[model samples]
Structures are given as structure tokens and as C-alpha cells.
Target: MPKWISLDFGAKYKLSRLKLWFRGDLEYKDGNYPTDWDVYGSNDPNPDGSWDSWTFLHHFDEPYKPSGLPHKQYTQEDIDYARSGIDYEFIAIPEAYRFYRIKFNETTGNGAFIIITEMTYWGKLEE
Candidate 1:
């Protein structure tokens, strides 16, 4: 099964970028990070709204392989890099949104889960 996470920004904002950090723990190495995912944004708060109400922001289909090492055994630098987070700039998206969603389609390991340690969104509040 696929996994997803949603964030409510409370109000509409001109989203500029997003930062995502995956779990850096040494024990949970297999399939800990997302390999394929899609990002969506929505301003409609109605629960009955359809999926079409959300706008597609981006789709990442590449594997999340920060460390080139085999067996997914990462070095200290890799761990630090993961902890620092990966940035996704939304330069093409000019619209404002009140909510953001991340849908995970695949993971690095055989597991069916995606482990994200942190998520940060940068944007300017709509006036």
C-alpha cells in the first residue's frame, strides 16, 4: 500500500519551496525514504471536494539514493545530509494554497512505508 502525508497551512500562501528530511537512523535503512512521490496543493477546505480541486505541484519518480554505498549502509556524511533535508523549489507554481499533500508511491527498500523525519514549507502569506 502507498503512504501519504498532508499539511494544513491554516491559510493560503504563496508557496515558494519545500524541505523534506528522511529518517537518518542507522537501524532503519531499508526502504526508509521515499523513492517515488507526488506533491499536490489545494486551497479548498471542503471535505467533500474532489481530487481535482487539488493542483499538482510536482512528481518525483527517482529513487532516493543519497549514499552510493551498497546495502544502503550510509556514512556519517550521508546521515547528516539526510538530516539536513532535501529542498524542492516551486518556481513554476505561482498560485497560492492553504494545504499541501505528499503522496508516496515507492520506497528505497522492500518495505511499503516511507519514513520522513521532518517537513518544512516556505512561503509568503496571502494578503
Candidate 2:
């Protein structure tokens, strides 16, 4: 089974960039990060309880695979990286969407769960 999270921007916007952080300042060996996933955008007026009328945005396949002792254990750099968050810029999307979603694949984590410490987005309003 796959898991996902949805976001309602309350209005339409031509999204440009997305910033994300996974499990900040915590044990990294918990296998609580997404390994494979995809992002989607939707403008359907009634998209609740459904996965319909969505436009594909991006796919993340192990975008950041933690390796080595420091990643498993503790390190100032690792903590800082988690705290700083990762940025992803979209590639020229002309469509503006009021809703966004991140759908996870079966390969997310070993424990079948994901932990996102924080997230943010940047975009301009659409007509």
C-alpha cells in the first residue's frame, strides 16, 4: 500500500519551488523517510476523498539516500542538513493548481512509514 499527504493552498498559484525536511534532529536509522514518491497538482473543485483530475508534477526516487556512520548516528552536518531542508524547483509549469499532493510508493521506508519534519513552497498567484 502507498501513503500520501495533501495540501490546500486556498487559492491557485503557479508553483515554482518546494522545500522539504525529513525527521530533523532525530535518529536517522528509524527508516522514516520517503524513498520513492511523486507529487501531483490538482484544481478540481471537489477533489476530496478522491485521486482524480490531478496533474503530475514530480517524482522523487531516493532523492537523498543517507549513507555511512554519521547518517545512521549523529553529526552536526546531518542535523544542519535536516534543519535547513532540501529545495526542489519545478520545471516550467504553466498551470496553476489550488491543491497539491505527495503520493508515496511502496519503497518509501522499511517500516512502511515516513516522517516529514517540515515543508514550504514558493509561487505566484495565478489568474
All candidates' TM-scores?
Answer: 0.76, 0.75
Clashing pairs in 1: 31-109
Cα lDDT tens digits, model 1, 1-127, are 3777677888888878778777667332666766678888887745864576778888875433466665556677667776667777765676878888778887768577767777888889985
State how far residue 110 of model 2 sits from its true place (Å): 2.4
**Which pairs of residues collide in model 2?**
none
lDDT of 2 by residue, 2-65 (tens): 8888888999998898887776544344555555678888888354657767788877755443
State candidate 1's TM-score: 0.76
Clashes of each: 1, 0
Which ten contiguous residues of candidate 2 have the minimum total lDDT?
63-72
Q: At residue 38, what lDDT does model 1 achieve?
A: 86
